[model samples]
Target chain A: MSGAAAFWRKYGVLFKSDWAIMMAYRSETLIWMVGAFVQPLVSLAVWVSLSGEGSIAGYTASDYVLYFTAVLVVDRLTRAWDVYELDRDIREGTFSAKLLRPFHPIHWSINGNIVYKTFFAMLMIPSWLLLAMFFPAMRIPVDMGTIGLVILAIALSSAIRFVIGYQFGLLAFWSNRATAMYALYEGIHMFLSGRIAPLSMFPDWVADAARVLPFYFTVAFPVDLLTGRLADEPETVWIGFAGQAGWLLLLALSLRFIWRNGLKRYGAAGG
Target chain B: MIHVEGLTKIYRVHVRQPGFVASLRSLFHREYREVAAVDGINFDIPEGQIVGFLGPNGAGKTTTMKLLTGLLHPTSGRIEVGGFVPFRQQNAFKKRVSLVMGQKSQLIWDIPASETFLIHKEIYEIPAASFKERIDYFTEMLDLSLIIDKPVRQLSLGERMKCELVAALLHRPDIVFLDEPTIGLDVNMQEALRRFIQSYNRDYKATILLTSHYMADVSALCERVLVINDGKLIYDGAISKLIDRFSPMKRITLVLGAKIDTSVVEAAVRNGGGRVVAYDYPQLEVEGPREEVTGLSAKLLTELPVIDLTIEDPSLESVIGLAYSEGAAGESRR
Candidate 1:
C-alpha cells in the first residue's frame, strides 16, 4: 500500500482503541452530555421567555428553539479539548512516548476528537429528535441539499475549533497557565458565537462584528446555516463559506507556526 | 553501533527564593542557572557489544541515555546511534533502536498487554506472522503466558517489567538502551531478566547499552563497563580490569568443618602476608595481594582443618565504590 493508505490504516486502529477507551468512560460521557444539553436548553428557555407572545427581533419561540437546538448540535460536533489533553501530556512527560513514535503526536488527538464527537452525536441526536417530536415548530425540514451544506459547514467549523484549541495547547511549552488563556478564549467565544442568543437579537454592530470573527464561524454560523437563517440569501451564504474557509486557513497556519516553535522550545528544554 | 564525542546537556533551571518579596520581585526579574547534566562524555560501542553504563544517582547516566535515545538534544557535542543523529529522530533511526526506562512505562495503563503489543505491531509495521511468533516466544521466555492478557495495572512490578521488556524487544531493534531494567525487582527476577538479556544479545547480536545500580546486572551482561561520575566518565574498560585496578586485594573465605581456633587461622593468614578481614567461629574471610592467593590457600588448606576454602576477587559493589571515591578524590585534587 501507499504511504497515505498506511497512515489511514494506522489511524483506523487508533480510532478503534480511542473509541474503546471513550466507551469505558460512560459516566463521564453522560456528565459531559448533560453539560452540553443544559446550556442550549437554558438558552432556549431564556429566549422563549423573552419572546413571550410575539417574536423578539424576528425570532419566534419556535425559531428560538430551533436555533438553540442547532447550537447544541453544532457545539457538540465542533468542541475540542485537545488543549487539556495536550497540556497534561506535556506536563506529565507522557508526550515523550509520542515524540519517540514515527508519527506526529497530533494524529492521536485527531483520532480522539473524531471518536468522541461521533459518540456524543450518537447520544444527543435521539434526545434532539424526542424534543422536536413534541414541539412541531422546532422541527427541521429533511432537505438533502440543506443537509449537505450544513454537514460541510460543520466539518469546516470543527477543523477551525480543533486547530485553535491545539494552538492554545502549544502555549504550555512556554507558559504553565495556557488553560487560563483557553478559558479566556472560551469566554469570548461564548459572547460572539451566539450561545447567549441569536446574533440577530444583538445590536447591528455586534452582529456584523460576529459575522467577521472566527468564533462566530466556529459555533453560530453553522447553527444559523442549519436553522435556515442563510436560506433565502444565496450570496450571504456563500460569503459565510468564504469566511469559514478563510479562518480555517489562517488557523491552520497558526497551528503549524506554533507547533514548529513549540517543538523547538521543547527540544531545547530537553523534554 | 553507537558513537558519541563530547556529548553534553545543560539544563537551565529557574532560581527562586522564599518570602513574598522574593516571589513578587521574581515576577519582573528572574534568575537562572545553567546546570550541566552531562558534561563532554565520550564512548563508542561496536556492533553487537553489550556495554554497561555505571553511575550513581544524578551522575548523568540517565542523561546520557536520554541523549542517545533522542529524548533530549545535547547542548553541545555529537552523537550518532544506529547511524543516525538521534535528535533528528528519523524514522529509519527510530526503527532500529529501542529505549526502556525502568521507572517509566510505555504500556497503556487501562488495557491488556496484548492491546499494547498490537499497537506496537502497527507502529513498527511488523508483519503479522513475525509479530505472533515474537509475542509467543517472548511470552514463553518471560513466563508471561498468564499475565500478557491482563491489564498492566493488575500485574506485579516484576510481571510488568517482564512485559515491558517484551514490548521493547518485539520490534527486534538492532540497538537497545536499558536504564536500570532490574530496579525494584527481587533477586530471582533480576537473575531471570539478566539471563534473558544475555540470550537476546547472543541470538540477535544487538548492541546493548545498559545502566543499572545493581552490579550483578553489569557483571553478568557487560564485559566492558563505562563508569561515569558527576557528569564525566572516570573509567571505561573491562569489568575484570576495573576490579583489578580499583581492588588490588583478593578475598578468601573459609568454612571450617571443625572448630578452628581464631589465633591458628590468623597466624596462618599472616604467614602469607594476608589480613583476616573477618573471623567468627569456624568462618573466616581473608584479604591479601592477588599474587598470594594460591599460596595463601595452600597454607590454609594444610595448616587449618578447612573443609571448604574459596578464593575470589572483591565484590563488584566494593570495587565500583572504590572507583567512585577515587574519581571524587581525583576531582578534588584537580
Candidate 2:
C-alpha cells in the first residue's frame, strides 16, 4: 500500500477502537467533562461579582459569562491527557507494546485525541446552541468565515498542547516524576493559558508574559477567537494562528528529538 | 533469521541509600551508576527453530529479546533480524517481528479482546480474508470463543494471556519473541499455550525465541537452548547436550523384594563407581554415569531380589541450575 493509504487504514481502525473505548467509559467521560467546568465557572462567578453593575478591564458581567463559556468549550476541545496516559504506560512498562507496533505510538495518542475531541464537540456544540436560545450570553454572533478560523485555531491549539503533553510524558525515560512534572506544567498552564480568566484581565506584564511563552496561544487564542473578541482585529487573528502554527511545528520537532533519544534510554522496565 | 554480535545495553541508573538523611542528601547530590543489562552477547537463530533462553532474574534474557525485536536500542553492537537492523525499527521490520511479554499487556483496557485483534490486523495490514481465517483458527485453537468479547480487564490472567498471544501472532510474524509467556498461568493453561505455540511454529515456520521460569515449557517446546547469566551467553547447544555436559550422571532406582544389608548395597554401588543417594528397606536410589547405570543395575538384580529397575537422566531443572552456576562463575572470573 502507499504510505498515505497505509496510514489512513491504520488510523481508521485505531480511531474506531478508541471510540469504542470512549463509549465504554461514557459515564466517566461525562463526569470528566462536567468536572472540567468547575474552574471556568468559578472564574466566571468571581469576575461577574467583581463587575456587578460595572465593568472590569472592559469585560462586563455578560461578557464574563460568554468569555468563561468560551474558555470551557475551548479548553475541553483542545485539552490533551496524553501526559497522564503516556507517563503511566511508560512507567508501568506497557509502553513497550506500543513501541513494538508498526504504527507510531504518537498516532495512537493522536487518534485518541481525535476521538475524544469529536465526542466532546458532538455534545458541546448543540448544547451551546440550545442554551443560547434562552440565554443571550451563550450566543456567538460571528460570521461563518470567522467560525472557520476559530476551528482552525482550535485544531492548531490542540496539536500544540498535545505535542507538549506527549513530550512531557516521554520524560519518563529519564525520571519517575514525569506525571508530577507535567502537573506542575499544567498548573502554570491553568493560569497563563487563560483558562482561569481572560488574558486582558491579568496585568499587562502577566498578559505579555503569557504571549511570550507558548501558553496563551494554546488556550486563550482560540478562546478569544470563539468569543468574537477578535472579530474586528483580523491581523491579531492571523497572528494568533501564526503563533499556534509556529509552536505546533516546534513542539512536533521536539517530539521527534525526544522520542529518538528517549528510546535509547528506555529500560523497557518491568515489561 | 536472527543474528547478533557484541550486543550490549547499558542503563544509567540513579543510586540512592536507605534513610531520610540519604534521601535529603540525594536531592542535592545524586549519584548514578551504569549497569550493563545485556553485555556483549552473540548468537544466531535459524527460521523454523524453537530456541529456549534460560536465565535467572537480571540475567539479561529479556534485554536481548527486546534488542532483537526493536523495542530497545543497544548501546553498542550489531543485530539483524530477518535481514533488517532491529534497532532501526523500520515499518517493514516491525511488521515481521512480534514480542509478547507476559507481564505487559497491549490490549486496550475497557474494550473487548477482539477489538485489539482488529486493530492489530490493520496495523499489520493483514488481508481481510486472511485476517478472518487467522482469528477463527487461533480462537478455535486457543478455546477463546466464549470470552473473546469480554473486556480484557475482566478476563483471567490465563485467558488474557491466550488473547495476547492471538494479538501478537495475528500478523504471522516471521520472528516471535516470547518473554516469560506463561508466567502466571495454571498448569493446564500453560500446557495449552505451549501446544498452541508449537503448532503456530510448525505452520508458519516462524523463528521462536522463548524465555520462561517454568522448565517444563523449555523441555516441551525447545530442542535447542541458550543459557545466559550476568548478561553473557554461557552455553548454546541442544538441551540434551547441555544436560550431558553439566549433569553426566543418570539416576537409577531399584526396589528389592527382600530386605538386604545396607552395607552390601552401599559397597556394590561404590564398586560400580556410583553413590547410593538414598536407601530405605527394599527401595534404594543411586546416581551414576550413564554407562554404569546398566552395570550397577545388573549387580543389584543378581545380588538381591530386584522388583523394579529404572534409569533416568537428571531433570532439566537441575541441569539449568548447574549451567547458571558456571555462568555466574564465569562472570566472577572476568
Candidate 3:
C-alpha cells in the first residue's frame, strides 16, 4: 500500500477502537463535557455582570457572551489530553507495548486526539446551533470563506497543542514530574490562551505576551476568527495562522528530539 | 535468529533508603548505583528452535528479553535479531517479533479481546484472509472461541492469558519472547498453554525464547536451556547436560522391613559416596551419583531388610538451584 493509504487503514481501526472505548464510558465523557462548560460560562457570567450596561475594554455584555461562546467551541475542538495519558502510560510501563508495535506510537496518540475531538465536535456544534436559536449572543454570522479560515486555524491550533502536550508527556522517561510541569504550563496557558478571558481584556503587557508567545494562537486566535473579530484584519489573520504554523513546526521537531532521546532512557520500569 | 554478544545493561537506580531522614535527604540529594542487569551475557539462537531462558528473579531474564525485543537500549555490547540491531527498531524488525509478558497486559482492559485483535490486524497490516486464518487458528488452539469476545476485565486469569497470547500471535511473528507466560496459571491452564506453544512452534517454525519459574515448562517444551544467574550465563546447553553439570546425584528411596540403626545406615550411605537424605524406622532415602545407584541399592537390599526400593532422577529445580548457587559463588569471588 501507498503511505497515505496504509496510514488510513491503521488510523481507521484505531479510531474505531477508541470510539468504542469512548462509548463504553459515555456517561463519564458526557459529565466531563458538561463540567468543562462551567469555566467558560462562569467567565461569561462574571464579565456580563461587571459590564452591566458598559464594557471593560470597549465591549458590551452580549459581546462577552459571544467571545466566551466562541472560546467554548474552539477550545473543545482543539484541546488535547495526551499529556495525562502519556504520563500514565509511560509511568506505568504500558508504553513499551505501544512502542513494540510495527506502527509509530505517536500515531496512536494522534488517532486518540482525533477521536475525542470528533466526539466533542459532534456534540458541541449542534448544541451551539441550538443555543444560537434562543440566544442572539451565541449566533455567528454565516460566512463561507471566513468559516473555512477559522477551521484551518482551529486545526493548526490543535496540532500545536497536541505536539506541546506530547513532548511534555515524553519527559516521563527521565522524571516523574512530567505531568506537574505540564500542569504549570497549562495554568499559564489558561490565562494567556484566552480560555479564562479574552486577551483584549488583559493589560497591554499581558496581551502582547499572549500574542507574541504561542498561547494566543492556540485558542484565542481561533476564537477570534470564529467570532469574525479578525475578518476585517486579513493581515492579522495571516499572522495568526503563521504563528500557529511556526509553533507547530518547532514543537513537532522538538517532539521528535524528545521521543528519540526518551527511548534511550526508557527503563521499561514495570513488569 | 537472535545473536547477543557481550550484551550488558546497566541501570543507575536511586537508592531509596528507609526512614524519614533518608527521604528528606533524598529530596535534596539522592545516591545512585549502577547495577548490571545483563552482565556481558552471550548467546545465539537459531531459527525454528525453542530455547528456555532460565534465571531467578532480578537475575536478568526479563531484562535480556526486553533488550532483545528492543524495549530497552543496552548500556553496552551488541544485539542482532533477524540480521537487524534490535535497538534500532526498524518497522520490519518489529513486525517479525512478539513479546508476551505475564505481568504486563497488552490487551485493552475495557474492550473485548476481539477488538484488540482487530487493532493488531491493522497495525500489523495483515491481509484479510491471513488475519482471519491466524485468528481462527489461534482461537482454536488456545480454546479462546468462547471468551474472545468477552471484555478482558471480565475474564479469568487463564482466559485473559489465552487472549493475550492470541493478541500477540495473530500476526504470526517469526520470533516470540515469552516471559513468565504461564505465571499465575493453574496446572491445567499451564499444560494447555505449554501444548499450544509447542504446537505453534512446530507448525510455524518460529524461534521461541521463554522464561518460566515452572521447571515443567522448560523440561516439557524446551530441549535446550540457558541458565543465567547474577546477570551471567553459567550454563547453556541441553537440559540433561545442565543436570549432569550441576546436580550429579540420583535420589533413591528405600522402604525398610524393620527398624535400623541410624549410625549404621549413615555409614552405609557414606560408604556409597551418598548422603542420607532422611532416615526413619520404616524408610531410608539417599542420593548418590547416578552410576552408583545400582550398586548402592543392591548392597542396601542385600545387607538391610529392604522391603521395596525406587530410584528417580534429580528434579530440574535442584539442578537449576545448583546452577544459580554456583553463579552467586562466582560473583562473590570476583
Candidate 4:
C-alpha cells in the first residue's frame, strides 16, 4: 500500500475506536442531540408565531419550519470539537504523547470528529424525517445535481469549521485561557451563521458582511442549499462553494502556520 | 544508540506574589525568572545498554529524559537517538524509541488497557503477526492477562503500572526511556518490573535509560549509573564504585545469644577503633573502617555470645544522600 493508503487504514482504526467511545457515552450523546435540536425547534416555533395567519419576510410558517430544521441537522452534522480537544491536550501536556506519534495530531482529531458526526447524523435522520413529514415546506428538492452539490458543500464546510476551530485551539500553547477565546468566536458565529434566523432577515449590510465571512459558509450556505433558498441561481451556488473552498484553503494554511508556532511554544513550555 | 552534547533547557517561569493586589499589579507588569531545567551535560550510551540515571527531585533527570525523547527542545545542545535528532521527531525515529513516564499515562482512561495496546499497534503500524506475538510475550512476562481486559480506572496502582509497561513495550522499540517507572509500586511489584525490564533489555537488545528515586531499582537493574544534582553531572560510573567511594565506613550487625552490657560493647568497640551505631536486646550495629570492623568483629565474637553476624556496605540511598549533601556544600562555597 501507498503512504496515503496506510494513513487511511490507520484512520479507519481510529474511527472505529471513536465510534466505540461515543457509544460508551450514549446517554451523554443523546442529551447533546436534544440540546442541539431544541435550539432550532425554538427558533422555528418563534418564527411560526411571528408569521401567524400570514407569511412574514417572504417565508411561510411551513418554510420557517423546514429552514430551521435543516439548519439544526446541518449544524449537528458539521460541528467540530477539535478546539476543546486541542485546548485540553496542550494545557495538560498530553500533546507531547501525540507529537511522539508518526502522524500529525490533527489527522487523528479530524478522523475522530468525522466519525462522531457520522454517528450523530444517523441518530438525527429519524427526527429529520418526522419533521419533514408534518411540514411540507421542509421537503427538500431531492434531485441528483442538487444532492451532489449539497454533499460537496457539507464536506467543504466541515473542513472549514475543523480548521477554524483547530486554529483557535492552537492558541492554548501561548495563551492561558484558550477556551474563553473559543467562546467568543462561538458567540460571533451564532449571529453570523444564521443559527437564530436566516441571513436574509438581517439588514442588507449585515447580510452582505455575513456572506463575505467564513462563519456563514459553515452553516448558512449549506442550509441554503437544502431549503431551496439558493435554488434557480447556479451562480449563488457556485459562490457558496467557492467561499467554502477559499475559507478551507485559508484555514488550512492558518492551521499549518499556527501548528508550527504552537509546537515551538509548546517546546518552550517543556512540552 | 543515544548521544547528547551540551544539552540545555531554560524555562521562563512567571513569578507572582500571593495577593489580589499583586495579581492586579502583575497584569500590567509581570516578573519572569529563567530557570535552568537542564544545563550543559554530555553523555553517550551504546545500543542495548541499561543505564540508570540517578538524581534527587528537581535535579533535571526528567528534564533530560524529555529532551532526549523530543518532548522538549534544548536551548543549546545536540542530541541524537538512533542517528536521528530527537527534536525533529521523524517518523522512523519515533518508531524506534518509546518513552514511559510512571506518574503519567498514555492509556485511555475509560477503556481497557487492551484497547490502548491495539491503538498503539495501529499508531506504530505494527503488523498483526508481530503485534500479536509481542502482546503475548508482554502479557506473560508482566503477568497482565488478568488486568489487561479491565478498564484502566478499575485497576489497582500496581496493576495499572504493569499494564502501562506492557503497552509501552508492545511496540518493541529499540530504545526505551523510562522516567520513575517504579514510583509507587510495592516491593514485590517493583521486583517483578525490574525483572521484566532486565529480561526485555536482554531479549531485544534494546537500549534502556531509566531515572528513579528508588535506589533498589538502580541497584538491581543498572551496573552503570549516572548521578545528577542541580542540573549537573556529579558522578557517572559503576554503581558499586559509587557506593564504595561515598560510603567508606562498613556496617557490621551482630546477633547476640545473650543479653550483654551495652556500655561494655560500646567501650570495647570504641577502643577497637569502631563506632557503635545502634544496640538492641540481641543485635548490635557497628560502623568503622574495614580493617577495624574486621578486627572488632573478631573481638566481639570472642567476647559476646554472638549467635549471628554479618558485615555489609551502606545502601545506595545513604550513599546518594551523602553525595548530594557534599555536592550542595561544595556549591555553596563556590
Candidate 4 CAPRI assessment class: acceptable
- Taking the tens digit of each residue's C-alpha lDDT, what string does model 2 give over B147-200? 899999999999999999999999989799999999989999999999999999
Q: Which residue pairs overlap in candidate 4's backbone?
A: none
- Residue A75, model 3: lDDT of 84
Q: Pick the candidate with the highest lDDT.
A: 3
Model 1: residues >4 Å from true position, as ranges?
A203-205, A267-271, B247-321, B328-334
DockQ of 2: 0.65
TM-score for chain B of all predictions:
0.82, 0.81, 0.82, 0.85
> Where is model 3 more than 4 Å wrong at Cα?
B248-318, B327-334
Write one digit per residue (lDDT tens) for candidate 3, span A1-271. 7778887999999999999999999999989888888889999999999999988886689989999999888888888889898999998889989989999999999998999899999999998889899999888964988889888989999999999899999999899999999999999999999999888888999999899899999999988888888878989988998888888889888988999999999888776
In the range B1-334, model 4's lDDT, one tens digit per residue, is 8998888888888898999999999999999999897888888999899999987778888889888888777889899999999878788988988888888887888789998888888888888999999988988888888999888999998999898888778778889999889988999999999999999999999999998777789888999888887787777778887776677789989888888788888887887788888999787998988656778888878877899999877665677778777673344211
**Global fold similarity of model 2 (TM-score):** 0.89
- Model 4 Cα lDDT, one tens digit per residue, A83-147: 88889888878787778777778878888878878888787777667777886776786576887
* Pairs in clash, predicted candidate 2: none
Error of 3 at B139 (Å): 2.3
Instruction: Point out the worst 10-residue segment of candidate 3 chain B by lDDT.
Output: B325-334
* lDDT for residue B45 in candidate 4, whole number 0-100: 93
- Report the C-alpha lDDT of model 1 over B157-224, residue by residue, as the tens digit: 99999998998898999899998899999999999999999999998999999988786788889999
| TM-score of decoy 4 | 0.90
Candidate 4 residues lying further than 4 Å off, grouped into runs, are A267-271, B248-318, B328-334
DockQ, Cα level, model 1: 0.34
Position A74, candidate 2: lDDT: 93
Better of 2 and 4 by lDDT: 2
